[model samples]
Target: MIELFGDATGNSIRAAIALEESGLTFEPRKVALARGEHRAAQYLQLNPTGRVPTLVDSDGPGGERLVLTQSNAIMLYIAEKSGTLLPSSAVERARALEWLFFFVTDVIAPNAQAFILSRDSTAAHGDAVRRLKERAFALYEHVDRRLAERPFLAGRVFTLADIAGYTITTASESELRWEALPHVRGWLERVGARPAVERGRRLFRSDA
Candidate 1:
């Protein structure tokens, strides 16, 4: 079994949702960031960066455990481990990876950094942050355009590309609104309606 260390609303939930959708059993080890658990000694030893969603894979050879810190790395790990969420063809797989890379580089990271900057009000700004937000929104618009034709990211099936994109993109809405992006919004509703995503959403809901 794998143990995932993360908070409730973070990408750990995304990993859990992916694992559930992958039909793999894993232990959910909650690390309460609000209580400063992620900065604690033990977790620091596990992840020097003190990040959440550290996946401790216990089934590796010689009893050696693998600790994956980044959420994208964890998603890719679980995706490859299950071998079902990714497309079968080489070209399709390459396209899936292409979208995955685009989401991380073009969409999630820039928007998140700018969102943090705008929220914090301390970060220096110039054409950089504006360009960051612009590029992020532009990539989102591109995603909306692609989703207008296909229900999923890679193609017809709900692959790991959608899983990766859905988690970060939806969360980015806290700073970047998707309502105006009708095509992306439509895709979000379609993917968000999945059973696993619903379960994951309930995990963050106060009413749940």
Candidate 2:
């Protein structure tokens, strides 16, 4: 069985979404951040970065157990193992990876900044916070335009890129202005309506 160590957050949500889409049987092990469980020595040994969302797969990599950290890596690993959520064609696969990395490196960066600023705020950080929000919206506008051409991020098919972007943006919804990004808003609606996505969103939820 696959064992996932994580809390309720965008990264964990995305990884859970991938697993749900793959129809894999896995156990959700919450690494509580509130009580600082992620920073504990034992957990840090599994993930040196001391981050939530570590995936341990029993039947992985030549029949050996595998330990994976990083949400994107987890998504890709699950997709490869399950033969799902990735483009079949090489061109499409490259495109999918491009957008996935874009979501990781560009879109989520500003959102992360906004989250940090909100969590540790000073009157001095007001302008910086606004700038981060604006940057995130700008990237979303670009995403919206890209969606105007294709139903999903890479192309007509729904892939891991969609899950990666959708989860993060949905988690950070309050900080973004969604009205101006009509295409993105509609795309999100399509993604959110999926039963697998719904199940993944509920995984590790505080109420669940």
| TM agreement with the true structure for every prediction | 0.85, 0.92
Candidate 2: segments with Cα more than 4 A from true spot: 121-123
What candidate 1 gets wrong by more than 4 Å, as runs, is 61-63, 119-130, 174-180, 202-208
lDDT, candidate 1, 143-206, per-residue tens: 8778888878888778777876888767766656666688888887888889977775555334
The candidate maximizing lDDT is: 2
Per-candidate clashes, comma-separated: 0, 0
TM-score of 1: 0.85
| Candidate 1 collision pairs | none
Best by TM-score: 2
